[model samples]
Target: MVFKRLRQALGVGGPSVETVLANPECRPGDHLEGHVQMVGGDHPVELTSVALGLVTRVAVESGDSAYGTMQEFGRRQVTDAFRLDPGQRYDVPFRFEVPWETPLTDLFGQRLSGMTVELRTELEVTRAVDQGDLAPVAVHPLPVQERLLEALLRLGFRLAGADVERGHLYGVHQTLPFYQEIEFFPASRYAGTINQLAVIFMTDPQQTRVLLELDKRTPGRFTGGDGFGRFTVDHATATHTDWPAQLDTWLRHQAG
Candidate 1:
């Protein structure tokens, strides 16, 4: 009897969980609607709580070596204190608001090489917690963001890769702990002058602040330094501005 009790306490008879998102594709500042379907195990179990979180892999730097780590950026509790009878089934629906600063995982219908976002459901049994597999989610760019990306493409910058860095920018009002850097390789015209460019967008409902970092190429062994430029515009203004021209001016100023 004692052994059986111990086994149950250790989650041998815990419940199983499967989460389904109504739609896997979303944009930043949007809401994700989903349902958590659960089935009781062989025996009745007491559940402490049920919750969901948004998780992704981020690049972390330590002691001159950099490694990637899985991090949870957002979480929401779905339920608390539930009793599951043997073989019983229950469904819990949830509407989670995606943060305004959520990173983009897809562009032009293609997934970024190293970028991913997933929805994870966690079922808390007496003393054990079971986490479900990552439900893949594709986060697309906002309207303003799309315009900027299109402009860059028109200027001959190709998408290289993107990653989230595990720290705050030097002078940015970032609500989240990390920021996404969308990288691009310079066009043929500027290949000799610039190695690459990384862009970061800091946004709110009112406006977006665009940060540009240009990595210059050098002839000598010593690497060239990064040049920075910042600009702010409202959503309406973003659509009308001549981004390619403005970007060209910025690059010229940075290179000189």
Candidate 2:
């Protein structure tokens, strides 16, 4: 029975955790709910605080290669000092708002593969020492976002990848340290007109802010004054309208 006892002891001794958000996805000024579960180990321990972080992965350029780093963009303290006895268990819950300028993870109906936004939990057992993470919360895309992405695929643009990058445009109010970029490759018809398009959505409760940046392989003689278009669409229209035609119309104006 020694081997069986050891195996069972090692397997079930660690902490068990769970995280949830009443509304997993939110507009600006909206709140996210979180729940965490912790179970005592073989011995008793003093607890400090339970912390939650809103994190995203970012790719940074370093020399000839690129590397990904986890950025903890937002953090919250959910529970204060406590103590746990051997074989005891507990749960802590919280509610917090997503930042107003949170980037769009999806535009229409597709998943942004390279994009990962996680609500992570950290157990602070002491003044400065804390366990890295217990669980991750997923934030899904909004309805208006789904509609817009559906429009893109219909327009023949293929999803390249998406990421959150650090920086701000010349004229925009940015609250978070980074912004999300959902990128696309031009389909055949627009391949000759444009190389790639990067779309960004800055959202709040009332509107969906859209930023489109195009990298064009200019033809020999056609002169286009600018290569990018930035605009905003209200939430009502984004959900009620057909975006493929609207997007095509926007692209036509860009070509002219």
Candidate 3:
């Protein structure tokens, strides 16, 4: 009996989980609908629950060290306790609410470098749990976010990379513990003044906060352009504004 229980805990002859998303691509604040297909194995079992979560690789800084780990920011429970018999099959449907602060993992139909967002299925058993394989989901940017990115490209800023950092912005309205930073190589005009630039957006239902950081080429020196600047605006305002021109003005003032 002990060996049988141990084998069950170790997931030998356990239920298999396959999560199928109705649509693999989604934007922030959107709903992700999917179904969890499960198949029982050789023995009867009592299923405690079924759940799903959105996970991503995040870089966290602690004290004087930094490490990268997979973090689950959004989670949803699909089913309550249930029983499963040998060779029994169960299909549980679920709708996961995407957080407005979810990072953009795909842009222009391309997955961002150093960024991945996946959905994981979880099944609770007696003494142990089983985590399913990661199902990749492409998180696209919202309209306002797309506009801002386009403006950067139009202003001659080259994309370097992007990643999620497990921390909050200094002066932004953040609802989550972590934020995403999209780094870019400075435009040629500002190359002499700033080394690079990073953009972060903290979004909610009402408005979006745009955070820009200008990295100085020479540190410890008084460079007008080396600091953080935040711009708060709504969706309609951002849609109508000439971001290329406005961004240029912001950079010029920083260079002075």
Candidate 4:
């Protein structure tokens, strides 16, 4: 019994954990329901804690260079300390709230390129921590966000790329450490004035805030600078708002 206890303390053959999400797709400010299933190993063990975290890849700037790293933006504890016996099975249900500033991984039922969101489960043993398999999840855009994207598309802008950049946006209220930028190539009508445009969304339960950055094009060796425009709309008014016309006005004002 002592040898078995020693092994258990060392986490030589502790319990295994697997997380399953009931709904693999969700929008921002939503809840993801799941369960952590555990199966005992050769010996009984004491588990300190079990938690879930939302993780994604972010770009980090170092000196004059930048690199990619995995970052966890949100975490929630699933269970407290517990004891598991040999050959026993346990299931712990969890409902985790997805952050309001969570980045979108899917658009129009299709996964966006270079975007991924995962739920990570961590099991704490006496002397070791075992990480469960990552559960991939799709975070769709909110109704307001969807409307804005549709307006951009209607204005002849094509999605060039999207990425989550480390650091906060200037003059924006951000809960997460990173912000997502959806890049677009300017339409033919605006190509002469701007080279590209990028959109960022910061949302809450009440309203959705949008930031538009226009990268103006210049001649000679000097490149043009960025012009920013910001606006907010209530969730209820998103579907009824004239997004295309409003966006055109904003663009013209910025260009002028």
- Give me the candidate number with maximum lDDT: 4
Between candidates 2 and 4, the one scoring higher on lDDT is 4
lDDT of each: 0.82, 0.67, 0.82, 0.83
lDDT of 1 at 184: 97
The estimated TM-scores of all candidates read: 0.91, 0.78, 0.91, 0.91
Q: Clash totals for all models, in order?
A: 0, 4, 1, 0
Model 3 over residues 82-141: C-alpha lDDT tens digits?
987788988898889999999999876677889999887778877877776778888999
Error of 4 at 82 (Å): 0.6
Which whole-number lDDT from 0 to 100 does residue 71 have in model 4? Answer: 91
Better of 1 and 2 by TM-score: 1
Question: Which portions of model 3 miss their true places by more than 4 Å?
Answer: 1-10, 219-225
- Compose the digit string of candidate 2's lDDT tens values, residues 58-175: 7776779887888886678888898777768687767776776654554344446777666666766655454444243345556666677668888998989888876666687666
How far out, in Å, is residue 75 in model 4?
A: 0.1
What lDDT does candidate 3 reach at residue 136?
81
- In lDDT terms, how accurate is model 3? 0.82
Name the weakest run of 10 consecutive residues (lDDT summed) in model 1.
Answer: 1-10
**Candidates in descending lDDT order:** 4, 3, 1, 2
Error of 4 at 32 (Å): 0.6
Global Cα RMSD, each model:
6.2, 5.9, 5.6, 6.0
